[model samples]
Target: MRKHWKSSAVSIAIATSLTLAGCSSGSGTNDKENVSSAAPSSQSSGGVSESGFPIVPEPIKLKMFTRIAPVNGPFKDMPVFQDYEKMTNIHVDFIEAPTDGFAEKKNLLFASNELPDAIYRSGLSPLEATRYGASGQLIPLEDLIEQYAPNLKALMEQYPEIRAGITTPEGHIYAIPGIVTLAAARTDKKWINKAWLDKLNLKVPETTDELYETLVAFRDQDPNDNGQKDELPMTARAGLSVVTMMSGSFGLDQQLGYNINIDNDQVQIWMGDERNKEMLMYLNKLYKEKLLDPELFSHKEADFLAKQGSGKTGFFFDQTNNNFLPIQDQYVGIAPPAGPHGDRLQAQTAPIARDFGAFAITDVNKYPEATMRWIDYFYSDEGSTLLRFGREGEHYVLKDGIPYYTDEYSTAENQPKITPYAGGGAPHIISDQVASYINPPQVQEAQKQLDPYMPKVKYGAPMFDEETAQRVNVLRNDMDKYYEEQSTKFIAGALGFDKWDEFQSTLKKMGLEELQQIYQEAYDKTK
Candidate 1:
């Protein structure tokens, strides 16, 4: 409701652990301090009060297992957490791991049964959240949200997708998500080189046929003006992910891979569909015609960036073309072209509630209510401002109603020393208003082309019950690999569509029907 994301079908993306930051209410206090700005009368004598500071009468310490973003300092050193400790009189022993190695360490902690009190920036998949939640390793959070999470509760009521995304089929909310309402932060951008388009006197393509004609013009004519046919009309690296972005134009929803799509409230596997075959045929045409990157399936990131840097790429995709620096100015974001059926959508763009496991309480936690209270503050506007932007007067200041970083805190050298205002994904609610404050102007402008096409009701990553998860996992482990291989072959012209019926039969034999059934069951409950 806050950003109106619930009006659409928002899929929950898997997000995990991240580390500490601080919030200041002007005064700083020791981590072990028992005093708070709020008077102690409103607080409970032995537990968390209904309102106010010093959540516990006596100082309490929580052990949190989290991972630090490379930009931010240790959680123990962050003034936000320190100031928070002072306000609540709750000391936390933050056990942090490096971003690169966090996943392994997090898994080990669970495997050893030596869990901390709670997890912050915890990167749990929907399946993992459901599995651990069902097993009682991660505690249920619905009751806690009802009692101690007024801000989160209000948001959930306003935006039901937030509730839908995190709630397990069995009715457990195992994790707290990091909410981002910025449109620019959501999807991989489709950037077309407008400079090239202008050189060839072409309008920006608005349909699949127009796009093909544009690519043909780009290939046949030297739009780059180098006099040699060196331009790559459309280029991408080795992955079906590019195809995922392109599939929406073909009237398919292929967001998070596995060729999974939903149509008319029913789960439909698109891998064997004729539409998918049509999409592949189009791709194969590009590959054979030399309009696509000849090494589409083998190029590394370095080579990909190098191509864009050379400024000869007619169309390509990326989260941001910041990698292509000065040359990126030649390009502008383009919405997906309409297909034969007038289907034009961006299935990839994310919802306001992006990360499903930014924070979670484990069964080992002793003060669940206090922890819930602690995290709930972040969902509030003021609390989110503090958590992400640092202090009002010191780190950033409001000028003409928009937040701007103080000169001292804005520098690259000092920015990371203070907090990760630049790097998000922490467990906080960053509205478009606040989130836009940090984006560079170019990124902000490019997203304008994509915003309108972002789907309102696209399905997201699915969660499963224990039995379903097991069976789904078994089928996916085998089928996913086989699917990738076969699909790549199909795209490369190694496997022809004449085997389309055989591919469908093979997928059914590999239990594709059961996989769709399990997903359908989980999906129906959300509605």
Candidate 2:
């Protein structure tokens, strides 16, 4: 049902450019009567309608790829999708990739030109989107958004940064971003086992030393009270995230955070700083003393969550554990403990404009207009509600104008599996209104614990030009690999502290300064 995108050779660029330019640009004078408009035609556009349920007059199937956790079963078996198909008159041939190795598989799909009609839940980096869109592996969507996606159009007008964040150097929009408007949904909170602390007669840690001592107590005191040394004092999931989650105490952030500290509008990369060295030493101390989880670098999310929920995890960090683990009220969110130098920045804060690649169309699609109209639904309030809370009467019930999951889906285990938003792969808006309903009170209170220490000015992702994007990716690819390797060794004590200076020097030699300069230039342009 698809043709090879074969994006090789110089001639392909011209052909692709012509194809992109020739598509309707929403100029009223040149409107195609046969395409997504009144007049009927044989093209897939004939099935598409202007508005309402059954996005198309007739059934049409789109092949797309997205992530799936094992617990969620097959994507097609999802209740929302099962109901949504009847509502939309659209069938999705979902190519499900397991969440763990999905990234490597996604890369292979693009590299091998085994293009799906679209990519949903696509975590496309700005570089990947730009590179592919520029080369025509992915199609430009700005014109399509203008013509077909009223919901998305309204958002771009409402949040102008959405446009700025997703637009490419050549002024093409390759992907639709998932916007997170909820304040509490943004940052990772450092969660401590309040039950453990109370059992050990300990207060929440206030300083680095206090945290160290408390962890030691957790190791020796048998806080779980089973009289067995089975408690894991601290743990992480999906490998090295413990470092990222705890990095704020040392004054850095995680994931898409890129280790930046923008103080007084001066951008700096903290990877090479001596303060980071201190943080590494502290982590090493924890490692040597067995205060940290012995499986910190190797534990999977499933294992970690099971352990956290089992009443023996003294500490962990995540956006919210109330939904993931059964020990909801047992743990309390702690603010970043004061480091030796007293820097206690929260690890991350929600930026209005977060990830840009939520959904994208590849050039092989014959139904770009239909696809745009279908995906745009999630951007609307009604569509977002469906994606988040499912059909209101069935999945949730309204009580005093607030949506609450029914008893059948109320427990942590069932809610995560049954909620329409489970797996979190949809290209939808989770507005503050949605967050108010979905983020349990415990989660809300935990987020409050983090508010005072969060950075005053939370910087969103920087939009780099194509050339700068390429260079930054090149430098970051090498430097990030080296940093993670060396840092892990530093924490595990595989690398001696004497090599610390060598690590810093290696970072500098690997274009660390130039990387900072590029980000600085991008950051400045945002101002």
Candidate 3:
């Protein structure tokens, strides 16, 4: 769930044959020596009788295929995994790949039947998880969680919605997800240059009309005081720009590209609704008046940040107010402006969210129970603390029983270098309790903006099945490209409401009905 990209390779007959021969030669144990501090015992179960921690006595090794964040260093050298090895008496032979190259390598490994005991951070989608689970490549975890995963079981019981999200229509959980409950739900925070607003003697806009007037004032009067007329009233990058946040004001849920929602237990595409038409009209007005960024459709994140760095941007849409370094204080996070229909919802992330597929045990694994127990620790308070914060005295210091980064691990420059060395950035489950108490002061303060809108946060419905998934992926991909092209035209005044009916018809022709049907079926099954 950290800052990791996806990676892929095709299956080849030669690779599969070679893998089979290698496996048949011997059990896949590496010649690496025991470097952990745990004392080796003769008992395989280690005769240990604890509810959590130290699952077995004799060291059992597991082969794990995982992806490493660029900041997390090499998997084998991470202190967090090493400490976990000692605590669980389970030495993991991590077969890790770079984030960008993991997806391809994972498929190649699976195609070659060279699957390890389990896979971590495999980046599998819900549909892929279902397909693999049904095909027996990925083992079902309902029974395992019931027996060996006390911490995870307790978590599911506490948050039943999470359990529902992960459980497929066929009634099985094929993967374990990272529980992100802290500030995870608030996705669309609009940050304004407070310094610019103060200089212009303007109040924070409370409605869309007021926002427009403010932006117009920003354009007519140089709020930056540079007398160059260079200040952009608002700026956002190419994909999912400020439009995503503003679209919510039009009674549409446009997050995750689907823009589909379950209303009164019925599936519908919010983007296809009449309200979206009005939204686009308003955006076109802004584009015509040059209130919105001129290069918004082609600019990248770097370009947007560069504008912020040069103090040329007045309004920015983002999750945090800390993007512009050295001048971060000039920005302040604020709630989205209310719409005419009083719509003011922000898109919130699902709690049972997996970063692609963070944890899954394969059919080749011989120690399902032990592996389940090993992973369950991460969901526990003690285990999550160790995984997220690392060894207390060494990596961080405890103040009033709460962990805070020491001087060495506090700054941005050193945090990346020290985090991987201390073993804190690896993939692991962190509970809402951990996130609320452990986050730094700035993060906790920004979370206050969610108190008013958190309950109304919009969440997308669950997706399932490989066939439906594949079809939807194709349709969604084609439709997204079309939407971008059409949106640019409409905002640029090249496409107008005169062709709006034609646009709707074209969407229906592009499989809108089929997409809705697929989502409706999945939604009913989940219910």
Largest lDDT belongs to which candidate? Answer: 1
Ranking of candidates on lDDT, top first = 1, 2, 3
lDDT of 3 by residue, 1-527 (tens): 00111110100000111111112000121111111123442223424323544566567778877666565656665566788887777788877666665556666776676778877765566666777788888899888788667777776786665576666767898877765545542354576778888998999887788889989988988887877888898877675465566776666653222565446667677655787788888888888899988888888766876776667787866544334656777776676677778876554433344333468888888777777767777766666666656677776777766666666765544444433322222335555444432344544554565456543322333645566666777887787778777877887788877988898898999988887887666556544
Quick one: how many clashes does candidate 3 have?
Answer: 9
TM-score of each: 0.83, 0.84, 0.82
lDDT for position 128 in model 1: 72
Alpha carbon lDDT of each predicted model: 0.71, 0.70, 0.62
lDDT of 2 at 369: 80
Clashing pairs in 3: 7-102, 7-103, 7-104, 8-103, 8-104, 9-104, 45-57, 46-57, 124-357
Span of ten consecutive residues with least summed lDDT in model 3: 7-16
lDDT of 2 by residue, 126-152 (tens): 777777787788999999888778878
Q: Which residue runs of candidate 3 sit more than 4 Å off their true CA positions?
A: 1-50, 184-186, 254-257, 302-311, 352-356, 417-427, 431-433, 436-445, 455-460, 492-494
Give the Cα-based TM-score of candidate 3 against the true structure: 0.82
Off by over 4 Å in 1: 1-10, 13-41, 52-59, 69-73, 77-79, 99-103, 217-232, 236-238, 254-258, 294-312, 319-328, 391-395, 405-424, 437-448
